[model samples]
Target: MKPESDGGSEIKNYLVDKREKSSSRWTRVNKTFTIYDIRLKISGLLEGSDYQFRVTAVNTAGNSQPSEASQYAYCREPTYTPAPPSIPRVIDSTKHSISLQWTRPMYDGGADVVGYVVEVLEEGTEQWYRATQKTLKTNLFVAAGLQSNKKYSFQAAGVNSNGTGEFSEPSVEIEPVEKLSIPDLDLPDDLKKTVCLRAGNTLRLFVNVTGRPAPVLTWRKPGIDLQSRGFIDTTDSYTQLIVEKVHRYDSGKYTIEAENPSDTPGPPGSVRVKDYTKESVVITWDVPSIDGGAPVNNYIIEKREASMKSYKTVTTECRKTLFRISGLEESVHYFFRVLPENIYGIGEPCEIPESVLICEVPSLPQDLHIVDIGKTSAILNWERPLHDGGSRLTGYAH
Candidate 1:
């Protein structure tokens, strides 16, 4: 006898071989004895679950494996599920683009995933557009050529023979940023006058300007009419002047003119030169608060220091910011002042605020003597002097 399950009911079939009419392969004693075990083969199944089965015993000792089992409850081919793909991460941003990278998916459904698909949507846009083509690559990608200051949304999915997998949650929209404009000119405080240098001494100054297309710079020396031959000028797009080897003759007001065709004119800047000394000098001036014209040159360094009575001339032309003095003599006091100079002429001289004195001797003790002597140590004493020949003498040491 053979039995098969149909839905919830069991259907029995009486079977008898031509030569086995009395054998257990046929109906026997109201109980069915199966000569062979019943097996089921399932065709299709979803990934990720177990299939059920059941078995039935037979009266035949040799065929005890049970041919009367519920074949409908048995599993044939098993199915395995794949893990979901990892969420993509945004790692970098630019004015017009964003970069995205992702981890591998934990599950690939039942089949191996072939590629990944990316989609993006602009803010307020109802439709989503494909951002990238299907790719097996697993590196980061830049969503380039995006609109500046615009927001966008993005998502990713896995692709296989079964078609695209479910999409991940959309990432937060990020807007592309616009490029920054150039900075405006803001002169420093305490800049009021032109720089002053002794004969054969050099001075330097600084000026700052910011703008798009870069600002143009022009230099000037006020108060003193600068002969083209007497003045030297060099320039970069940002700075205008390079005063080389300045001298006392170079002392005057210096004007720094900054201009940018892309922007409104910035304030005209100036530095004053004044207070000449044998070795060093000092200068005080005011910086322009507003950008009126263009960027100024760095500094027109002027120096005037000479071992002999006749001084050599050096000029740092096309300067904008603070000015400095160099080539000063040691053991000599100096007074320096800055002035604004430009094509218009030299501006008023800024007074010198401090005095710089270069001394020949290093700081050391002077006029030392032993007051009393011991076996190992000696008591020494000396009187500190107010000044040494109008020179500051720290002390002399042994």
Candidate 2:
């Protein structure tokens, strides 16, 4: 026992006893003692017997009051080693880092657990390295600066005043991977095509993309552009542009651009008339060179007659590139044009020459009859037709 007062003389001996009453006889447990001595052993006790012990200090000043009785103890060898810590398991991970968690040891060797130690082993190596510089007071730890695509294992151990306990079983292996990247565009091959849309028709363009650190997209037109006034939407892997209506002036090259830190612009897209008849014309086109990393929404078509100075839209929202314009006047010279539209806006126009003509087949002749019949031949007569189809009729064949 330590001296209660610093001014007191050094302790000479200690009086010990195993009784509750102060009047009971006491026994001297230690004869060879020192002033600094604080621990003692009382032997010769029977196993499974209840016993309470107290001690008193004998200093030059006087014998000090006895200490409170210690709790009963069953005679047995004391254990100072702790059980192994619970298994360590991974909780989170990244390309170069891993986090782990574990439970404390099941048996603490009669002492409170003070901290834990963590260790890791790389794949293909037999050596284990400490993950933390100091013991961790909590059950969780994050190990960082690991190599990507490599496997690793981990283990944990509990610590107390007695020392570190045995390590837990090794954790299952794990591997880290690189983050996702921006989309890759298959360049010149994709640029060769152009997108075409009919006037007054809807257009939808889709752009498919892939990348790490995913890319951002924007749609653009080369020259003075039509207002988008349309919806543009995007997804994890693709983007889309929608045009409700299209016009002739909407014709031109459209560009779709993608960027993350790097930029990839697609080739220019064009629209044109495919075929035309007396009353209607068909238009078709390819997709834009670059989709601006987004899909195209729709296309637009427009037309103008030879007499009109300005072009009029035939369709506002053409879904497809091919379209047929009907209800044209016969014998009238006209012009047909197309435009490609995306969510960005309408592009430049692809127009045909203004010399296209609307013509129809001739009508049948009237009052045709057989005037006379002969044994070998018959004579036929007919009146001139009401309509000449804007051209003189050649002689008819019987």
Candidate 3:
């Protein structure tokens, strides 16, 4: 017990006593204790007896007045032990290390938890090895010096003044592996086949590849690099190229290449019809963009009526990049496409939409009239022709 004083007197020691509430005489409970010591323990007290305690302070000057008696207090010892910690779990892993985490024990043995311990066991082994040194104050620990491609299991326990608690259930088995490797191109044979897309339409090309270290992909066209043009995009294992409002000039041999020390290029090119007329149409195409690492020998042209699926070769050995297809039906729609050929074989053909109608001559104008007549010259006017024959009208002749 402490005593209050008006003077600034320092305390030197304390004297304590206890007695039954009904008894008038007080009995000393302990020896005089130093000022630094404020606690006292008494034993051999009758279990059913009512008792009270009082204290006095001694200073350098003198002893202070006795303090008021304290209230009745009970004394008991706790015996419950703490439960084991939750199972340790792998939070993260690398080729050489793994991070483990766990929750605290349910009970701390009626005392504050001092620390935690972690243990690891290799697959197929009965021995468990300590993975932590000097106990861990945090719930997280990193286990290092692990071999790659090897499996491991782990567990954790809580420590208190009572000693280390029971170990938690072992974690699920896990294996560590290296995740880096060289690039492997995964271009399908169907993708290597040439494809024809309509003009003024959107063109989308997708290339898929796989690699351990992740390969760098690039798209290249004849005389142009798509990466420099900022037209290429990557998503996971796929590289894509999208062209909005594609035109004849957009037609070309496009090659997708994957590289990471080693490089692989796709095969083939595409073509399209630039313009059409009733009697003749101009077709333009690109060489095999990838060329299969060989020079394109020439191009082949095929034509068929829009109603037919079979195509007939118009020019099988054409060497020019452009061709004029003539002798077509005036009012009929025709499908025109071009194929690139190398020493190996012919590649996929690029085709245009079947809606391209051939142009034809317009019918004669109606309602011919002479607006004004003169001696030397006369002015004439007439209604325009009903059909322009799929071609834009420039003018009319007398």
Candidate 4:
């Protein structure tokens, strides 16, 4: 008969197979091999029925050395104790691996435990499988080739000279999942503004787009059905709408087209174009037919000396047209124009040729002087005036 261990340890047979030299079959061993209760006093005796008992046939000749016992003797009081291995707290977890640590068993059946075995089972599963490690490990158990998201349960056992110990209670379940990383988008959130027109002759439109692969930028004019406006063109990073000489016609709405596999619906952004006109000679203007812009808020009438480099604001009012102008030098070739303003910004000035100017004194003598003043008959002379109501000045002596 053999003593079987529930935990995994080698089976120990207490019986020595006893076949007399003539017997064909061996005898079965049982526990009833007691010998009159005095057998406990003997030193080299066993309790198993098939265990051989030595007899001495020393009749006068010194007994030959005792025959070798066929089987090992039963222990007088062999003790059995089980110490399950300690299950450790997990150190860390990653997408594909788990780390575990454990301590040595507390009770090794009164003998030094030889080794430990770890078993694992998927969470919520009953089938437990064995692992290959012979000793307790403190580092990560490199279990690769696993499902993306799953939990596994683990336990450990201790083995000693006597037998294996019971399995430890299941360690807190450990789970692993796939790692995810997102790429940066080509555009930012705050860059949603569609229109940009500066004080100079520049117009820009910006849009936002997102995808794994970056997208290309395209410029367009939404008002035009065809793409042939000659405005849309591409540069290094920007889609340029170059109005080489931006004018009133180029001062309408513009669209920015961003294209990728996902941009089929339509373009996402737009900008309004407006050119600035400051100097009186440059002849700045707005679309006369369409006043879509914030109607000119107020205009500033400016004047500069013919030889001077700087101009000064002469008048400002809510009116668009020039109504009244006074105190201007006569026949001085002075320039006059109207500047328009709006919520977006100031538009180009309406030049003088486009509008009429009222000369302070109607084309009259630019200079008058008294020469050789005299009484009624004294000689009088003066520079001839260009035009003065078509009349000559009557003389006065003063």
Candidate 5:
């Protein structure tokens, strides 16, 4: 709130200016004191830029002192409501109602998901209707009063304090019926995979089966009973067999006597360039959060000058997460990225936060002094510059 006194004069307007946290210069947010209210919306600021703003009130008496600068803020897009929940599957049903279940969305947008909304599209219609009268706190809901023998497609959306978000992809269409489907076993992707791992690595074997009520599971590997070695976990939808810290003895084909599901590696962590020099930099990164479905086989490195439109691969056979890229030109800005490769394929790439300047040549040599003097030549020595453009000096010029 403005001061009650206002210095006994009417306030005309306020002037706003901003300064980047790393810079000493301040830039005017508004060219003129045209803002008459206390609240103002500043635009045209670059995203991810750190900045602070100060305000000055103008009146007939003249401009009041600028208010203390606001806290440093990182500019970014405003947050919104949660993203859509996973598609709703028909878990159970009857002639008059269908019970649907779904998983939460991977992204909650920005806020906690307070609840979910289910919608249904009837057969031969374009529009959809809300299946649930209220937001459901649980992951399951029953669409009561579903017309018997009518086909319907279902979708689910998430809700948070901000509001509702986009709907999930529609679930498989199903017709309402009293009798349920037949018993069956299904494997995701119909994939019979041979998982490769190093000794001391963890291996997971999972299967999901969809059948009428229940299906029995039997896991074995030729001579040994898997239950005696690898432990098992069973949930309503799937079962997981995990073997931790495997050795050469554990290397063999394993089979799931009875069951059925799903990523690529996420982007790598921040790229380290602290050991950069005028012509080279040692880049390092943390492994991706996910390794698709298998362990990372290798990493790919690529770099591009800021002015270039495409990146050139530096190496496709980097086995480690750290490598030194040299031959970079001095004073040029560069962008480097790394991608992880697993049995599946190469995942998305993670890039340096900003362009890097290979940087200038080494700083000037310090404490130069002539020690030995001769009639024909002189010997000179000096202390090296504190910063060598981040590298050791190959030699020195007289």
Candidate 6:
């Protein structure tokens, strides 16, 4: 083949030639034989045409027979349509828009990728619509102007100079919706049970609230405005209504309500004075429903003359709910308050609903005597010199 590569004669240059596969005539591709390397860059070929190439080594000997014809090659354009891209994924959504993203195609069909085309299809419709008329250079796009609660899917195709590529598979179905959590009140069965407390008993109601976004809260008693004495506290987790000294007028259905982003524990129940008399009274009460996370250690019973604000402690270690208080001044009005103690300390006092008046029920009559007596009958007599209490005798049972 040229006597061991040109019989040791330095090769001047290489002649590159090409021929259409349809004919046998050959044509030169270079005006000068200057290529000295094994590789050559071919140019100026009609697209979609098939041809073959051969190389002729030229030296001082003038020429060498053209190398056996090389393999046939298609002379089409180097760049072609891109391949389909990766499946798209939904990134974000709103009532009016949906955002999607995808990776560039695995193959750009021999050309540098230029842009992408996004297409969408609505639920319950067969037609797929182009999201934008102009191609997008980014791999991400947000399809706007979507109807609320409408389900839609999207597909993407790449673009280059050659043309648009095949569309990628459709993305997962999506339904655009404005996010909001309606405020809600969780009412326990205890809240629904009718309360049967006495007039002086405290009324405490606790309610739990929940929502995706925290909700604004409101307490409603419908027709009646709450008394200044009543207290209510609201927090993110709970709502508390505390009517310290509830009266008959306070007996009614209480409702705790709230409103979401889209919309909107306290002390013991009070001391109750009952079955009171001239020298003694029975006081009973319930512990505060919420102890601020502490258990009640004991209850202190306090009493004061209705005319005074200060109170004298009756007992500091009373553990039971009911207590019998004695030595009260007969016919004098008194007010009583009770406080619960825990590890945290003494809590707020729960006072009775109203001032109580010592009862006027009379004491036992004076010494009795028998004025006359017989085997079958006896005469009863008694002196009225003893205290008459505060009220006149209504009658006597004989």
Candidate 3 lDDT at 18 equals 88
- For model 3, the run of ten residues with the poorest summed lDDT: 261-270
- Candidate 4: worst-modelled 10 consecutive residues by lDDT: 263-272
Q: After superposition, how far is residue 260 of candidate 5 from its true place, in Å?
A: 29
The 0-to-1 C-alpha lDDT of every candidate, in the order given, reads 0.51, 0.70, 0.74, 0.47, 0.80, 0.79
Off by over 4 Å in 2: 1-40, 43-79, 178-398
lDDT, candidate 2, equals 0.70
Candidate 1 lDDT by residue in tens digits, 32-81:
44324243333354333333333343342322233432222322333243
Worst 10 residues of 5 by lDDT: 256-265
- Which tens-of-lDDT digit does each residue in 224-321 have in candidate 2? 33245556787657777677687866666766777763323233344455454557656566655543333344566777789888988888887655
Q: Write the per-residue lDDT of candidate 4 for residues 63-156, one digit (tens) a residue.
A: 3343344543444445454577677557654455666666777776767767767778887789998766455433235455544236787887
Task: Summarize candidate 6's per-residue lDDT along 185-223 as a digit string, tens digits.
Answer: 888788878977887888888889876446777766757
Question: Stretches of candidate 4 above 4 Å error?
Answer: 1-65, 69-81, 133-142, 177-398
lDDT of 5 by residue, 270-360 (tens): 8887686678888999877766544566899999999998999999999777999989998789999999986658899999999988865
TM-score of each predicted structure versus truth: 0.28, 0.33, 0.31, 0.29, 0.33, 0.31
Candidate no. 4 TM-score: 0.29
User: Model 1, 290: alpha-carbon shift in Å?
Assistant: 20
